[model samples]
Structures are given as structure tokens and as C-alpha cells.
Target: MPNILNLQSLLGLAVIVGACWAVSENRRAFPWKLAIGAVLVQAALVLLVFGVPGSAVVLNAITGAVDGLATATRRGTQFIFGYLAGGEQPYVVQNQPALFVFAFEVLPLILVISALSALLWHWKILKWITRGFGLLFQRTMGLGGASALAVAANIFLGMIESPIVIRAYLDKLTRSEVFLMMVVGLATVAGSTMVAYATILGPVLPNAAGHVLVASIVSAPAGILLARIIIPETPGEGGAHADYDSDLKYDSAIDAIVKGTADGLMVVLNISAVLIVFVALVALVNVMLGGFWLFDGPVTVERVLGWLFAPVAWLIGVEWSEAGRAGWLLGVKLTLTEFVAFIELGNIPAGEMSERTRMLMTYAVCGFANIGSVGITVTGLSVLMPERRQMVLDMVWKALFAGFLATLMSAAVVGALPGAVFGT
Candidate 1:
């Protein structure tokens, strides 16, 4: 039997769409028809891609790519860790007391994956795919050309790099269009980071890489729908259709690899630094919260977050029993960053979370949609279009909400799926 109920999923969908509308300054001007169309198209894409037999070929192609990445990462790991790569003896003998040596040992894989993604982009592989997807968004969502391209590119590139595709249009884009770009950028994971996330969650979930990759693709339209609701586009004022005329110029394959390596190094360092600070801050908060001793028991940040967001999780179809835990992780992802949330999720005892709950959480926490991302998007966009700095700042909060709703939409779809389909 199908695990999803049409009415319930539809209601949850309405809540997300309505919430987006309610939060916008120009709520009365929302484009309900376009938003509905976008949602339907997204739903159709997910059903076709995941529900059909012929679609397996396309999925197989994606799986093959993921396997290639996993193989390369493993080989790179082996080169550094040698026979200790698997940590078989330490795990079996119980001699190593250290709980997080593997995290440090595998850190180099982040750089490797980032470099590989850069090479793929330079080779025009990712760009071709993104352009095709961009065209689809343009047709279905009626987005301005530059905005469509940026949203599509976001499926594969980082928040900053995707905007560079629409650099020429940045200054001319309307407030709504610019807000859509920022929201989409925050709503999806970059191709490079997807590989790193796969590695982080792989131990706990089957098909980890594929799920993360799929989540970003599925979230694109959701982002569009939410952005439209948050800041309705004024048809005559928005810029023309997007064109990614900016070719990724590289001298040679070797040159691409060298530059990509440097880019990846910066990303690795950034992730490491952010994680250290965020995790420590969470710990500090927990210590303070523990002192509360409400009801003669210690309260922690996790508990507070769980209480705050459990309703949202429940709205997305998580079981009541598991909603609090799922809510806590979602809150962490939104308030801090997805990287911090994933680390916590990864360390959670497997027995405490069901496969379905964890799967939903995986989709929920898959984006860079956090408080920090709002500033990143504004700064990045402002750099490309100095004249629009004020506009970017004006729409920052709208983009943040849109980005959050986009990820929630993705989780809602995942939650609505039959557990048998995803092997949950």
C-alpha cells in the first residue's frame, strides 16, 4: 500500500505555500497559478524519476557517477591511511578509545571531491546538465532568464558560483528575481559539498550520495514556488530570460585540476573552521541550559530546539515520537548550518532513529539554508551587482524563509513516499 495519503500531503503542501505567502510584504500580489504549476511539475518529476522502470537507466547513470566518486574517495583514503583505512582491528579489538579519529582521517576526501567537481564543471559536463534543467524551470516557472539559470546552476554549484553565471543580469534584476536567486542558492547543496555529505552520512544510510543529489534537484522548484510566494515577481519589471554565456575558461585539464585543488582547499578549511566554532557553541549552550534544571532535570539546547521545532517536523509527517529529535536537528541546521546538524545526526545512535525518520531528516537538512547563508548570499550578490546592495539587504529575510521552506518541501515529498520504495 502507498504510505502517503493524498489529502494529508496536499494539506502539508498548502501549509508551506500559504506560510510563504503570509510572510511576504506583498502577499496580495502572489502568483498562485505559477506557484501551483511549479509544485505540480516538481511532484511529477519526482514520481516519474523514482516510480518508473525505464527511469532506472537515468538513475543508474547517476549511481555510476556516485560509484566512481566513492571509488576515488576510497583510493585517496587508502593512500593516506594504508592498511588502517578500514580500522578493522581497532574496531574489533576495542583498543582505540578515540571516537572521532575517522572524521579527521577522512577530511582530505572533501578537498578531493571539490577538485573533481571543479574538473567536471570545467569539462562542461555539469554546465550542460544545468542549462537543460534551467530551460525546464524557465518554461514551467516563468522565471526571468538570469534567475532561471542561477536557480538551475544551484543544483550543481555553490551559492557564490551559481550567482556568477548570472553576473551580467545581477544589476538589472528586480527585487523578486534577486530574492529568488538567493533563496535557490541557499536551498540546494553544491555539487562538491554533496560528495562530502555523502561521505559523512554514508555509514548510516544506504544510497546516501544518491539521496543527497536527488534532494537538491527536487528542491529547485520548491525553492521557486516559495520565492514567488515570498516576493511575487512583477512581470514587466523582471530581467530577460537567463543565459549562461560565461564559459568556464581553463587553460588545460591540468590547469583545471590545479585551480580546482586550491578552490577545494579553501572550502575544506572553511567547513572545518565553521564546524569547530558551531559545535563548541552548541556545547556551551547545552551547559547553560543544563543549569536550568526544570522539573528537577537538566535541559539542554537540543531539548529546547526539539521543543521549538517538533511541530514543524510533525507537519512534515514525522511520527510524534520521533518528531522532537528530528525537529532539534532541523532547528540546528537552520540556526547554525547543515554541516553542524549532519555531524550531530551522524553521531546519533542508530537505534534511536528509525530509517524513515532519518531519511526524512536527511532530506530536511540537505541544504545550506541557515542564518549564516543569508549573509553569504547578500555579500556574494552585492559583489556582483554593487548597485543592488541595498535591495539584496532588503530581501535577505525573505530569501531565508524561502530557502527554509524549499528544504521542508523536499522533506515533505520524501516523507510522503512509501517506505518500501526507498527501502526505508
Candidate 2:
């Protein structure tokens, strides 16, 4: 981690931004102001949260709060899985292995967060925050009111849960708006899952919770900004609309809890299936790649994708020495899932990666932007708003690309800031 903000890094950032612009759905209508503005906002957030003393203190406080929440969440899991869930040891305190057991650990946070999100919405708290953030996004990025609300809500809600906030507006949304919704949904990870990721990476990255939280918040504006640039608003679309009042049709507190738990159950099952399938597929491909070894060693999908994305990682401030390592995570994240990428990142040995590279890569890889997410996004959103099912299918691939680019943009923005290097 060199402290210098050299010419190479500047060029890297420019190339990354240019690549994003080149892939715009309509290059002629690209929104440069929004793109630049969003990057600046993301940079400010990065500086304040990661750089400034006061802001870091506040963010640390929030991270500590989440740690407390995780502790409480662990209580429920401990009741169910006992020793496997890893709270108190059967004998004395010692190190615990990271558990991927669906029922024991990962899925419980989803269930808790889902129910908590419903309760917040039912209590009108989430509505107010969503409206406030929605208005802010609209003003900042020139997004439509409904689209702004949905994207803002996505900061704390799941892809499907967030869209449910704007369910009434889905039918009337323009193609650009629909695409924006899909991209933002795919670009950001859900809040409940953030807790799980933080729980997973907490061992390696101190402040893991804050970084994951910040990624979700900052990626919202970046996703909206990128989606607009990629697909500008059509003439006469509801780009001017800004109503934040959503029809939150929860029967009662108990009903919200029940429905949320049920939704989380279905999502847990889907996630379990996704992980099982992708892990097995990656192993199968690796086995084949292993049979055809190059002079250096056996080559696999990771090496191929890593070489492709190495420049992209370098473009976002990862040092050339560790660019491939960072890029490998990006490749894994995009091709498989962020979950797998995070697990790989967690597995990386201490000191093998510089602190700066690790932090930038964390920002880079923290998203739901993957190929498999395309199908999941379509399935989830279609069920939420069936009228847009065909439109969703049409723009699925484009949205996935937009989502990936948006996360890359987030990484780039954070990289551009002088304050992102740890221990500076």
C-alpha cells in the first residue's frame, strides 16, 4: 500500500469509469453529471466513514450495535443448534470453525432481519426513513419518486422486500425505471445478509460490519446513477413522480411477523440450493481445468477470470502486486455469487494481501451482482409484480451488467479517495 496517489492510479480510475460509460445502453444519452455526482457522494461517504475520526467513531458505534445484535441472534441459533452454532463452548472458550450450516447460522439472520424489517414497516418507521432517503436520492440523482424509494428501501431491505414497497408503481413504470429497479436490486446486498456476511468476515476484517453497511448504502446511489446512464429515461416516463406513500398491507404485528418468517424460509431454501449447485459446479470445472495443466500449473475458471478482471481491480486502486488476488474475488463474485467470493476472501491467509488491497476488494466484492442473481432477481421480482415479468426477462442480462458495473464503480470511488488505506 503505497501512500502516493500516483498517475497510474488516476489512469486506472479513468479507465474504469470509461469502461462503464462505453457499455451504456445509449451512449449518446449518458448522464455524466449524475455519474460524477454519485461518485463524489460515494467518495465523501468513504472519506467520512473510513477516514475522518468523528465519522469513524459514529460508524464504529453502529458496528458495535450490530455486533450486539449478532450476539442476540446467536442466542436463538444456539437454542436450536447447541454446540454447532458456536456461542458458549461445551467445555471452555476457544476458537470455533466457521459454519455454513443453513439452519444453524446463515439462515437465521435472514429470518430475524426479515421479520424485523416487516415490523419496522408496519410501525411506520421504515416508511418515513424510506421517504426521506427516497427524496434525497431523487434530488441527488434525478430519479423518479417510486424508483428512488425502492432503491433507498433496498439499503435496509431485500431485493424482493424493497420492491414490495413500490408494488403499486410497478405497472406504470417505464422500461428505464424497471431496469433501474432490477439493477439496484441486484447490485446491493440485503441488510439481513449484511449481518451474516459481517459475522462471516468479522474474524478477518475488523469493522467488517461497518464496511458491509457502508457498501449497501453507497451502492444505492451508484446503482441508480449507473442504471440511468446505461438506460436514460424515455420521453414522458414517470421520471418526475416522487410519491413515497406505499401500500404496506400487513394485517397486524403478528401477521407481519408470520409473513416475514415465511418469506425468509423460502429465501433460505433458495439460497441453500444456489450455494450447493454453484459450489459443486465450480469444483467440477476446476477438476476439468486441473487435467489440462499449463507450464506454471493447472488453470481454472478463476485464473481465466482473474486475468480478465485484474485490470478492473487495478483500475479501482488495488496494487498490481495483489490485483490478481483482488480480481480473482471479483471474478468469483460475478460469475458465481458474492457469498462464494466472501468465503474465499475469508479463507485467504493473513498478510498474503496488503491491508489496502483487502479493504478495496471488500468494497468491490460486497454485492449481489452475479450471473445466477439474474435468474433469482427475475423470479423474485416477477412474483412481486407480475405485469413487469416480460420486461424483467428482457432486461435481465443488462441489469446484471449494470449491477456489476455499479459495484465496480463503488470500489473505484472508494479507491479514488486518499483516506481508504488502513492505518494511514
Candidate 3:
């Protein structure tokens, strides 16, 4: 029998869900039945992708695309590093290896991927895929068309940008619908950032891109589940009925590339800046905590967080020895942001974590679910729908929980699957 009594996992799920419920306006009317059904559906989908052979093949195809991207990124790194392995490696290359690989080589590749994604969207490739996935969510989850589109868009776009697809519907979206949209946005990842994260974790874990891609897809339903739990979809005034207009005219493919590349650059810069400030703050907290003359020595914020989340790490099938390390990563992600946690995870010494733990952590931490994103969601959504600004604020906490749970659900699914399914 599978070891499923991972208390830390269960507790982590509970903490997020409970936080949402505690703060939600409609907490009393949370749709427990619908929430349960959505979780079941997400679980079923995970099992299909990781346990069934045919679904595994399809998943592998998606993973293959990500791996190909990673390989391309590796080649780009080699170009910048001037063949480190082929000749006498420079001292900088030897001591601070992969630094340039991450900053110059891998990060820029995300812009290329973003441009490629825009081209695909312009050509209707991603539209069809998103539509098919949207239909499945609409039928199974019974979400409105706008909600479905938002959720589907998350598979390809970022939290702030995905809502643009349903921009016309933003002002009139029901409270529950808006909440769902926010949840999905936080739950999934933008295609452009996925490549960057893949590059970040790729050096540490094999098949990192594939695992992150799968994790985002698997988290979709989980987002729905937790959203409904915090604010049940009560039958009320119908959501806004608006059509998506893709009428922004670009001169040509090159024009699209230029525009998209500019946009991706801004995003990358914002991400880098936020990460630097937030990490410094965390370090400051650790320093302050270190001054406290506790029982024997000082305990930093990361250590305390690791202790708090260790049980969850264990529940997710991480080996006992590695649970503390994994828990610290989770703590960092939850309190600060995924980017910082991922960077820290990447910096961990090789062999400190087993492959399974590393893979599960990748899935677990792949989301925009931390405290910072709450502000981003509120500010971005409010700008799009000024009238619903209060609703956006109201749903912010729940959306955070939903997003966190979504990632956990993905990790749990991967943890339960056999390693062969992921080609590990």
C-alpha cells in the first residue's frame, strides 16, 4: 500500500484552505460538495497522466517540448561560457559556475520562448489547445465561459495577463467567478516564465521543465477546488457575457517579436527586482532571529519554517533525511515567493536531496501563490474592473489559499505516481 499518512502534506493543505475560509466573506456558504468534486476530478486527472500508460505518453510529449527548450537553453549557456568543459575552465567558471548560465543564457531564452508563444497564439495553435482544455473544465467543473477561459489562459499566460482574455467580462463577473479567475491565475504559470524556472531548476533536477509543465496543468482543478471551498458559487446574477477581441494589430511577425520581447523583458526585470528585495528582507529576519539567545543557539526564519513544514514534506513522499531541506524551500515559497525558493533550491548541494524529493518540490513550488502575488492580483484585476475592486480585494486571501493548495495537489499527484511515468 502507498504511504499516504503524510501529516505535513495534509496540514499544509489544511493551513491554506483554512486561511481562505477564515477570511472569506462567503465562508459560511462554501460549496463543500462542489469543492470535493473538483478535488476528485483533479486527482483523477493526475492519476491518468501519471498512472495510466496512454496519458503518460501524451504528458511525455509536453514534457519533451520543455526538455527540448532546456537543451536549447543549455547550448545557449555553452555559447556564453565558451565551452567550459572543452578547455581549461576559468577560475570564475569553476567557482561561480552556472551564474552567467542562469542570468544571461537561460533568462534571455524565456524571451525567445515568449516570442514563440506569441507566434503560436497568432497562428491559433495555443487557442485551439486552450479551447479544448477550457471545454473540459466547463463541462466537468461547471464554470462559466469567462471563468473557463481565464483558467485555460493560465496554462499559457501570467496571472495579470490571463485576465486580459476576458477583459470585457471583468466588470460584470460574479464574486465567485472573479475569485475563481484569481485562483486559476495564481495556480498556473505563464509559459514565458516556465522556461526561466525550467532553466533555474534544470541544473539540479533532471527533466525539470517537464515536471514544472505537468505541475501547472495538474494544479488547474485544484485551484477550482480551493476557490469554491472559500467562496461557493451561489446562483446569482449571471457573469458578464463578453467576447475576446484579438484586434491589436501588429505590422508583422517581427513587430510581434519586438513587442513581446519588450514585454517579457519588463516582466523579467520586475521578477528579478522583487526577488532581490524580498530575499534581502528574509535574510534580515534571519539575522534578527539569530540575535535572540534561545535555548542553545539561534534559529533563523528558514529553519523555523522548515520545522513547521517538515511534516508536509514527509507526507509528500520526500525521504526523511531530505524533508527539512524541502520544508525550508516550501516555507520560503509560501512566505516570500517561488522565485527565491527556486533559486535557493537550485543552490542546494547536489545529492542532498533524492530525485523524488527534488521533483516533488519542483511541482510543489511552481506557482504565484505567495503574499506578494495577492497584491499583484488585487492591483491588476482592480485596474481592469474598477467596480469590482472590492470583490477583488475580498477574494485575494482565498485566491492565495487556492493557489497554494493547487500546487500542493500537483505535488501530491506526482508523489503518488511511479517514477517511470515521469521517466525518472
RMSD of 1: 2.8
Per-model TM against the reference: 0.91, 0.92, 0.85
lDDT, candidate 3, 1-424, per-residue tens: 3445344444445555566678666767876666667656766765675557676566557667777776675666566566552233555455455445345655666777877777777667777787778777887877777788788888888898788777867766787788888888888888898877777787788656666777788788888877777767777664445343433335677777787788788777877778779889988988878777555758888778888888777766677788888899989998888877888888876677777788888888999999888888888888888888887886688678778877877676566655665565
Error of 1 at 285 (Å): 1.7
Give the lDDT of residue 174 in candidate 2. Answer: 85
| Native-referenced Cα lDDT, model 2 | 0.79
Which whole-number lDDT from 0 to 100 does residue 392 have in model 2? Answer: 86
lDDT of each: 0.77, 0.79, 0.74
For model 2, residues 203-320, the per-residue Cα lDDT tens digits are: 7777888888888888888788778877788767676365777766698999989987887778778778888898889889999888787658789888888889898888778788
Q: Taking the tens digit of each residue's C-alpha lDDT, what string does model 1 give over 166-282?
A: 776676777778788888888898887787677677778766676778788888888888888877777588856555675455777788788878877887787777778877988
Ranked by lDDT, top first: 2, 1, 3
> Which residue pairs clash in candidate 3?
6-315, 8-311, 8-312, 9-312
Q: If the candidates were sorted by their TM-score against the true structure, best first, what order would they fall in?
A: 2, 1, 3
- Name the candidate that leads on TM-score: 2
If both were scored by TM-score, which would come out higher, candidate 2 or candidate 3? 2
Report the lDDT of model 2 for residue 181.
87
lDDT of 3: 0.74
